[model samples]
Target chain A: MRRMAAIIGCGAVQVGKYPDRLESELALDAVRMALLDAGIEKGQAEGIFTTPDLRGGIGLQANLLCEYLRITPKSMAEMTCGAVAAGLTVKTAVNEIMLGQIDVAVCYGAERECSIEWFKHFGSALFEPVALQPYASYGIIWAYAMSARRYMHETGAKEEHFAMAAVRNRRNARHSPVAAFKAPIAIEDVLESRNLCSPIKLLDSSASLDGAAAVVVASAEFARRVCPKPVYIMGWGQYHDNSCIIPTDRCDKSISSFVATREAAAAAFRVAGINPEDVDVAEVYAPFSPHELIIPEDIGWFEKGEMVKAIETGETEIGGKIPVNTDGGLLSRGHPWAVTPFYQTINVVRQLRGEAGENQVPDARIGLVHCEGGMMNNVFVLILGSE
Target chain B: MSKVDFAWPASRHTPSGREFWAGLKKRKLLANKCQLCGEMFFPPRLCCPACLGDRLEWFELSGKGTLYSWTEVFFAGPEFKTPFLLGLVDLAEGVGRIASRIAGAEAGELKIGMPVRFTFVDAGEDFTIYCVTPDTG
Candidate 1:
């Protein structure tokens, strides 16, 4: 049996929809809360991993954490994995502890993502404006819209079928104290919302918001000694895909997301030695509404063209057959790019510990957390459980 | 009947647009064939990053193609006065090309994999715009 690296204490703080401009200060607040929750002194932290969005300026996140917490670890690194960054960082910290490199590590993410200049452009103009248009133009919306349109066309799914995913998530978010969009949204409201990309209205998408969350992952020995109860990292997997189109453009391979998600899910399940049904809760990243339908199938929830019935029937909602994104998901929880996955992990850890108040699933044991970056260009899947 | 402006098509041009126009003037649809792997790209590329080869050749394409996928964009930006049909047209030379406005179809009338032919129109001032029109089989 693989030696487990226990998650001693997980602390997440959601400031509000529109928070202050101080990235490092917000991050410091989260770190303080996390260390307080873990009941550990700063000097005891043996390693640190930070996932900071655009702000916190450059290369200063780890130093900032070190200065604020006064925890100078022998090893420190800042990772940028978009929404899944912190969760991946936490997994990395656990792996380090397993390797005997560090005993205690803190993984954190802080960002004021809502109002920041969200556009980023780097190098070359082979495609000019197409490659560097300001308003999230990376052919990403096109890809998602295309897949969603195809799925709808093939399955005879109505616009309401897709809107229900958002409506349900928003309703769940109403129960979440920290969710960005807490107000209830209806199918009619979503259908009438301004269309960003065709068939993908603004209401059907995740908000670009500002917030921070942090978690403490420690060695099994340290966790057993220090924390109240610890969740174990049962499995973790990640995969990559091509940056450009291939010769034969098949959706399964050319997209890379399908392959990446499948491979990661397989590897994670193998490490945990369990099937999809063993997972009581799942938090798969679905920034776009259609992806909420696509990812579950890719990860072996059900076959293709099968999610609509499942999702529409409330089987994917809280207290349903399987509780997914009971924390409202990125759809209603907001996507601050690199800070999303930490929020996802927080929910997973909460459910596993039965700490999730309003959206708790009974006797929750194993939880799966997933984060997709650049529309499945990179997928990271992690499975955690109570021992 | 309402009079519409058709004399000058509002054309946008990039380096790719400029090349596609110049080639169209010569009755040729253009593609950038990767010098190393011999793969053709409709949007044109400066280098074949796939093969890591900088050498690329401008090959005249067989304008004959079929629509791979299509969408009728109901809501459009300022540049598009009307909600027009946009399609990813696959060229006979093995490249998926993006073009605007299917010539003979109303909104929601176009189907995927329909045969199409390349058409070029003057956009005033020694310029032209390229799009795909339905091909009569």
Candidate 2:
């Protein structure tokens, strides 16, 4: 029988510009908070998983974080899978604990992209050197914009649908004290915002900020002994398509539908033994507004070309059928790249714990967290339940 | 705030990719075809991504394809001009889609599934780049 793992505690620093602090400082603050929340001492963490500071190009990030926290971990690793890295780190910690490799593990990520000098240039560092770069200036926004255009063309989802997503997330952010953009925005505000790319206005994109988020995973025995309430990791899944550039090789048929997300969600649901309707809340990783519309359908929350109607009918808002991104997703919470997904997982934990003060969903028993990395190349899905 | 200065040196290419770049200088688009699976690949690869076969042949592309998707990028890197149209074109030969700059047309006029043809442009210092334009003819 496989040992089960659960999230015992979570923490995060405010998501905004922190130019005065280094990436390590932000990570240290979040880690300390997480330890406090778990009611466990820093010395209790036997394993450490850290997200690589790509924006800062810092070497030996895992070691540096361990040294700063005074954590003499038995095992450590640095994950570098872009936005989904944090989710992957959590999964790694869970596996380590389940295998009896460690009793408790701390997974944390931090980013100072707002303070980094080459923030814009860091976008294309992952593309194929000679081929992809020469054709078009490869950047995350350009790739997502192309996907958005195709999604709109296929689903009859106008730019307004994307605007509705922006407006919805910003509205949710109003209740989130840690969200970067809290002011409520209208559809007109999103539409009138300067165009970063056609069909993807400036408002449709998430802001790049400095932030850090951390989570503590414990073995079932450890949780039972110390933690009063633990959110069990009912199921987890990860998938990768390995396509570096956008308009993936499967673009002919699967442009709007992300195969990785579907496969990952399927695996997770099977392990959780729960259907899509059983999920009470979701915190999906959608850095762009169009993605917020498409990810729900890809993850089996909605049917083909039906997300527009769901959004229009207010089924995805707080108190709706499937309140998504209640803690102001990346759209309003500010995307700090690798560190952002931890915020998503943390939100799910809070919802399950009934600790979400203002953004709490009524009686949210089961919650789902989804994240994508590298032009939708990698996807991680986790299902958590209050048992 | 003090400005941070950085420079990225030219990229190094593998043997297969070197040939692909050499073909571009002569205005030819090249792809790799797997001998075992017969699958094609763009941005030329040494091994077949599908079958993991090492025996691959260099195949010149027809330079004609259909627009799979497109975007008008108003912001981009320093090397690229602002407000440019970038497209993902599905090669007619069934190799794969490639990202290319769309020229000789307005961004608004471009449509999905429109036929397009590849053209080569010189980027100075012996660097050649590929672009696509609507096959209006």
Candidate 3:
């Protein structure tokens, strides 16, 4: 018989600049907090999973993390799928527990990207040298800006529409004490911000920070014995695009609507036996403001070209039809790459447990968390429920 | 503590990639076509990405395409000037797309599906690169 997995504990540190601490140190802090939250000892964890560090020379980050925590795990693996690695790590842990290989699994991620002088260097290294380097400067922002430009042409969505997303996420961040940027912003402020790339103002981009987040997953049998309230991991799904190179090899011609997100969402919803309308809250990983407007439509929450209307009509706001990014998302909470998705998952758990004091959705029972990385190449979706 | 300055080292290319870069110096735009599948690949590849067939042949392109998308990069690496237009151009043959700096047009005036043609430009240190400009014809 197949077993079920539940998230018994979640922990995260403040999302902001932490130049004084090492990445492993930050990860260890979150892991210790998660164990305390789960009411378990270090010996209870049977497996360890971690997202790989962007900084090179860290061989087998998961094992290194285990050593730092002083816990020898029977099975450990490092996830390196860029931003989606956090969600993918959780999914892998859940599967490992469901397959009866482990009773409890811990997944965590940490990053110190903001302290690096040339963070763009790490981003540009992912591109094909001979083909894409000569044309584009080979940075992450340029890719998103190109996609935003195309999205504008297709949907007739103005720059103000993207500014709305930035303003809203920043506004929501005011409720989150751990968010990187708590100051509420206006649409004019976003529009007047410095332009990093065309149509992608500096305020529209997510700020990378040094932080860590962790979660403990356990078998349903184990959770019932020790845990009081466990957020059930109803379903999870992951998908990758045709190629990591720009202008996907497939004939999809869509610059904004990523097929991988749609596939991942569809699989998650199918496994959960639920529809998009059944979701009480959602936390989407949108590093850019334009992505905040594009991803909901791609996930089938709204129709094509209708997301802007939904945004303008207050349908996606905190008190509207479906509250999204209640923890301010990556845009305001600070995107630490691999660790960002764990924040999303933890926020969903908070909402389900009615622990999100000010940002709580009324009686939220089921929530969704989605994350993607690498020019929309990889997408991971998770569905969590209270029951 | 003190601030440190660093330079990014040059990237090494594969044998197939070396031929593609060398063609740029001679103002020759080359693509690899799979003999078995008849699929064309830009930034020429040794084996077909689709069929993985090794029977590949080199072909010259018309240097013509339409602008699929573009962005004016205000912040970039040390090697590039700020506020330059970078574009993704879809080749006319529908084989693949090319990404490069777009010249001969202002950032505001560029539009999706605008016709563009390829050109070769000399970077410092004997390195040549491919650029795209608005096709007048």
Candidate 4:
């Protein structure tokens, strides 16, 4: 049988505006913390992986980070697929462990988007397929806004319904120490915020922040030996549609619901041999509020247009049915692009280990994380379990 | 709308997208028709990224379509103006959808399925772009 991999440890540098810190320094801090948690020395890791920061496209990133972290590794790479790359980096490490190529692998992402002026150019440039660049300069919000508009059309959901997503996340953020925006916000706050795109307001968007996050993975045998609470890499699914055109099919790959999310979640649940009902908690990387509503429907947590009702009924809140984004998600917890998934993974790990503090789900056994890249074209769904 | 006030830095072209841009000068909406699968591509491409069949020919669109969805972008970075109306237009030929400026429409007036017609807008940097306007017909 092929060897199994487990997440031995994970760490995060509190996400916020760190103007003076270099991206590498932030990443190094998280890596150090993770190594300390895993009880593995820097020299023990045989491989290193990092997610790409395309907005700034840091030069020689993986190489420079390796040099700064002072680690010698047999293999290394900068995985590039936008935000989703965060989870893919860990999956790569998992593969290396399963193949017996490496005993331990470290994956991390660090970028000082808030500390730098390039923050203005962040989401806009990463989207827009090369084919569509000449057409118009559109950003992530506009791409998802098209989908949001269609969702509104189909579900008759008003702007207020969308705003609830941000409000709910902000409430959840109050309990998370790493969360950036913890102030209580009402739906009116989101509605009153300036429209970046018609359906997407500034308050509905993820904050620009500088930080880093990291995770360490090792073989099941190594994890069982040292780590007290290793979260097993249960199963994962990734779907890359990479379509720049507006989705034409109403039933599949449409503007309202993301078919890619459904397929990815389906594949993950299938591989894990678990159902949506079995998933105790979820952490989804949705940069915008509408995405939060659409994702749960696509993931089969609720039926179409049911997220709005779930919001009214407290179905997504902590102590609710699904308890999504217990760490407040990208909407409230600052999102550092490639590292968002790392934070999500760490939060899931915390939940499974019964260490999530106030945001913890009772007796949580399974957690699901969802991340998407480039206008929801590429997606990754990871299922991590604690046995 | 004799002089379109909106400005794009310059008309940029990809080698595969040259025909569609060239068609803008002739007031024609061009798409690529795949020879193998008979599928149409807009914002035209050399090969079908959707379907792998590469033998494609330039096909002109009717410049008539219905609005799929759209947004008024209020915050595009520098080099662009505020609050531009962009639309996803589904060609009346039932082939595909393309994103373009929806000219001469206010935010409060647009409907999802409203008819629109393609037109040329002089972006004033010696650049002309194909855009769509609400079709009263």
Which candidate achieves the best TM-score against the true structure?
3
Per-residue alpha-carbon lDDT of candidate 2 for residues B13-83, written as tens digits (9 for 90 to 100)? 45556778778779899888899999887766678888989999887989999998899988777766688
Number of the top-ranking candidate, with lDDT as the measure: 2
Task: Locate the minimum summed-lDDT window of 10 residues in model 3 chain A.
Answer: A126-135
Model 4: per-residue Cα lDDT at residue A338: 72
User: How many clashes (backbone N, Cα, C below 3 Å) per candidate?
Assistant: 4, 0, 2, 0
DockQ of candidate 2 is 0.41
Candidate order (lDDT): 2, 3, 4, 1
lDDT of 2: 0.82
- Model 4's alpha-carbon lDDT is 0.80
TM-score per candidate, chains pooled: 0.84, 0.93, 0.94, 0.93
Q: What tens digits encode model 4's per-residue C-alpha lDDT throughout A115-208?
A: 2345455442333333443345445567678888988988888888888888889988898867888889999999999989888999889877
The regions of model 3 sitting more than 4 angstroms off are A1-3, A114-118, A123-125, A129-132, A248-251, B1-11
* Candidate 1 residue-wise lDDT at B43: 62
Q: Which window of 10 residues has the lowest lDDT sum in candidate 4 chain B?
A: B5-14
Could you tell me which residue pairs clash in candidate 3?
A135-B99, A135-B100
Among all windows of 10 consecutive residues in model 1 chain A, the one with the lowest summed lDDT is A129-138
Ordered by DockQ, highest first, the candidates read 4, 3, 2, 1
Rate residue A251 of model 3 by lDDT.
Answer: 35
Q: What CA RMSD would you report for each candidate?
A: 4.6, 4.0, 3.9, 2.6
The TM-score of candidate 4 is 0.93
Assess chain B of each prediction and give its TM-score: 0.75, 0.85, 0.85, 0.84
Candidate 1, what DockQ? 0.19
List runs of model 1 lying over 4 Å from the truth.
A1-3, A81-84, A114-139, A244-257, B1-29, B34-51, B64-86, B89-92, B95-106, B116-137
